[model samples]
Target: MALEDIPRLGCGRSIDRIWGTIDRPPTAHEEQCDQCQTARTRLRRLSKATRSLRESDLHNPTMEPRPGIKNAIMDVVRAKVRRGSRILLRSADNGTTEISEQALSSLIRSAAAAIPGVHSRRCRIEIRSAAASVADEDHPTGTTGTSTNAGPRLIINLRVAAAPGIVIPRTVEALRHEISNAIPASVGIGAGTVNITVEDLYDV
Candidate 1:
């Protein structure tokens, strides 16, 4: 049954009860209640259908999205990628600063994509738990400069697709140079290792 067809307060309780009971043992009343059981069955089926549709949309967008669907779809994609591992960019008297691995990866990809023949792929940023030391630059003294006071050091892993006939070493070096200049200045964190993997090659 479509969600709208299910009465909002059916089964002698609000739909919240159905939501609250998902993936857990149902209460005594719910176990014997026909309406609640039926709703749960329908909802589970609906959930599976939703997943199938999402997979289809992801793999089969061969043509331009219709009307305003492109932006809507992109918004959903961005929201899904927004959260991941986090880093302490800096700390101060009042509070601490932080950024997600997603943000850091985006920065790295932007740098890599700016190069002539590199297509950015998956990127990851990790903090070495054992590498935390006092960064010199964290201060509340009204300085506009980025904190030299350190946070945990980062390890970056980047995968890219190289275009045919490009100088691979030179391209990777350029990505490294760009990343080195961009990451620290953008977020007051230091990097320990940047592992670049040339995972694929494609025609230009």
Candidate 2:
């Protein structure tokens, strides 16, 4: 059938020609052919009904969806079931690596002991295991992932007695960095955050 003789679909291309190309305009033939004309009329009616339904939905919004509702619903469902877990790593080299609260306390005490002026007895360390989500695969390496061997993330609280002349901010910052580095390296898990609390100031 000549392209022009074929009935034009709503898009302006002939029905036969536009069969595979849904986006194509209807052809002149399609506009004139009785069968094509009826098909086009029916399609137009359906389109109008669809649009009217959408308008009615907006006017008297029903729980029923318009078009892309299925996708949106699926996205919400997937988000709810997404998994979150943590991986912790421990160092084999140092006898220092420990998972228990007491073990962590001992580790911190030992670290404080190494600091020249810090008193081992006066310093207190509390360690707790906390859960945190692993980063998506798109995240950079070492960013977030649970190690099978390592436990969940660790939170360490260091309360130390500092001398009157000590720079608390500097000391805290230093301790934060040191602890962050040491914990992750010694235990095979990523550290989400490190916080150091200097609870007391002692004149020494």
Candidate 3:
């Protein structure tokens, strides 16, 4: 698993710390902290899954996901659920539209993965306070999925892994362009900047 994908608790400690304690007694701190104990329980289930996968002969023709990858991704999604981190699609006199971060993340990831030779790793959307963005003065709400630029201008950051031997610069540029166009269309708001980081090169 990529080190960056490690799941961290709300206290900022990685869950790997919990996994490390599998063979030994829990520390005094861990024993006292309910958060660590709860995370440990979840990690134990994941540990069982990892052990099972290690014993299996199955292998993906492309690349198999590393152990704990799903757990780590689920942690982020659960965090969003707890915090209710959401984006305002658009604000109009009629009403305001909003989407949860988890939903938007899914949409953005799907869009990125659609690009050939690339696989999306992470996507983050930052909302910026801005002037009202209405499609037209007459029909402020606009048509379905046509707010164009809705409530707030957004700054989007993306990290993707490209297949080895691909033209990194050209592919990333296409990714950036695609995201800039897709986000506004998918949601009501527009992305002011789409920042792409080709963080990893994976075997084809």
State which candidate has the highest lDDT.
3
Question: Order of all candidates by TM-score, from best down to worst?
Answer: 1, 3, 2
User: What value does the lDDT take at residue 93 in candidate 1?
Assistant: 100
Q: Please report how far candidate 1 places residue 2 from its true position, in Å.
A: 16
Candidate 1's TM-score: 0.55
Output the TM-score of candidate 2: 0.38
What's model 3's lDDT at 36?
A: 82
Q: Would you list the C-alpha lDDT of every candidate in the order shown?
A: 0.73, 0.53, 0.74
In the range 84-175, model 2's lDDT, one tens digit per residue, is 22222344665444354444444556566555433433223322343333332255556555535345555455666666777777866666
The candidate 3 region of ten consecutive residues with least summed lDDT is 131-140
Tell me the alpha-carbon RMSD of every candidate: 11.2, 18.6, 15.2
Can you give the lDDT of residue 130 in candidate 1?
A: 29
For the record, the alpha-carbon RMSD of candidate 2 to the native fold, in angstroms, is 18.6
Location of the lowest summed lDDT over 10 successive residues in candidate 2: 79-88
Q: How many residue pairs clash per model?
A: 5, 30, 1
Candidate 3 matches the true fold with a TM-score of 0.54
- The C-alpha TM-scores of every prediction are 0.55, 0.38, 0.54
